[model samples]
Target: MTPIERKLRIFVVEDEALVAMLMEDILLDLGHEVSAIASRLHQACEIAQAGAFDLAILDVNLDGKPSYPIAKTLRERGIPFAFATGYGGMGLEQPFTDVPTLAKPYVSEDVQRLIMGLMPSIP
Candidate 1:
């Protein structure tokens, strides 16, 4: 696709360090910038509310809680994001029911596809 021009700022919130790192690497490789990375629901909410990201990839669960609050903030600010989870379709919360998502263990191409799907006009 467009390869995400100009290092599009992205926020990645996943509790698993390895998965978060993998996502960060993928985003960087795609020529996008990782504005911030959070591994907890609270941290994700705070960062999302701070308004620094062009987009986000949020895991459905962070620590022991759902990332719904962060999702709410993203929606409130009109920030586009996709849920990333091992649980796939059944993992999404009510408010994020229709939002785009990526299943865990995703390949780089999977990330690219989801990003493209979320921002189709970008390419």
Candidate 2:
């Protein structure tokens, strides 16, 4: 069966509204339910804690604030996630060194593949 058929739930945290919309569209098209999308680190953390998402797509920087706190919370909850950034490998902080990342301007298929590979049955 296609990965989407499993119906994973994902949360998106991106500072750019347009990018968030595009990511949302891609996730929706993949047949997964988007639990929430937020632009600020505060809002993102709130949603991430409140929502029962299986995974998350985190933007390393939200405005000038780093998303490490949110990423830490996800890690504590045992939720799988990947960084999606425009900064390439230079964007990651030491804490996120081992997590998967996808550079921006990426193909939608990459998002789908990463999600499917990391969280086949939802976390």
Candidate 3:
């Protein structure tokens, strides 16, 4: 069997409506379900702490606020995640510099690649 299930539940932390919609469409086409979408830092953090999902796609910034706190929460929960950013590597800092980053204005392929990378190892 594959390393990942046929369907995954993902949480999205993006402030842009259009971008979130695009991501949702891409994930849906990839046979994944979006458990929740948070547009604010506080909301995202709360969900990160209490939400039930396999992975998360966190935008590097949310309304000028960094999404690192939410990312930290996900890490504490042992959930895998990728940072979505337009600034590329320059936008990341310590602790998250090595995490997979999904560049902005992404296509379905880019998102799919990140999702595949986040899959749990079978071995």
Residue-by-residue lDDT tens digits, candidate 2, 1-120: 355647878899999999989999988888888888989988899987777888999998899998999999998888888899888866588878888887898777888778877875
Q: Provide the clashing-pair count of each candidate structure.
A: 0, 0, 0
**Alpha-carbon deviation at 103 in model 3, angstroms:** 0.5
Please report, in order, the local distance difference test score of every candidate based on alpha carbons.
0.83, 0.85, 0.89
What are the per-residue Cα lDDT tens digits for candidate 1 across 18-87? 8989999998888888999999777788899996878899888888798888888988888888898888
Measured by lDDT, the strongest candidate is 3
Model 3: weakest 10-residue lDDT segment is: 1-10
Model 3: per-residue Cα lDDT over 1-123, one tens digit each: 123367889999999999999999988888899999999999999999999998999999899999999999989889999999999966798989988999988998888888888886211
Using alpha carbons, what is the TM-score of model 2? 0.91
So what's the TM-score on candidate 3? 0.93
Candidate 2 runs further than 4 Å off: 1-5
Candidate 3 backbone overlaps, count: 0
Clashing pairs in 2: none
> RMSD for each model, in Å, please?
2.1, 1.9, 2.6
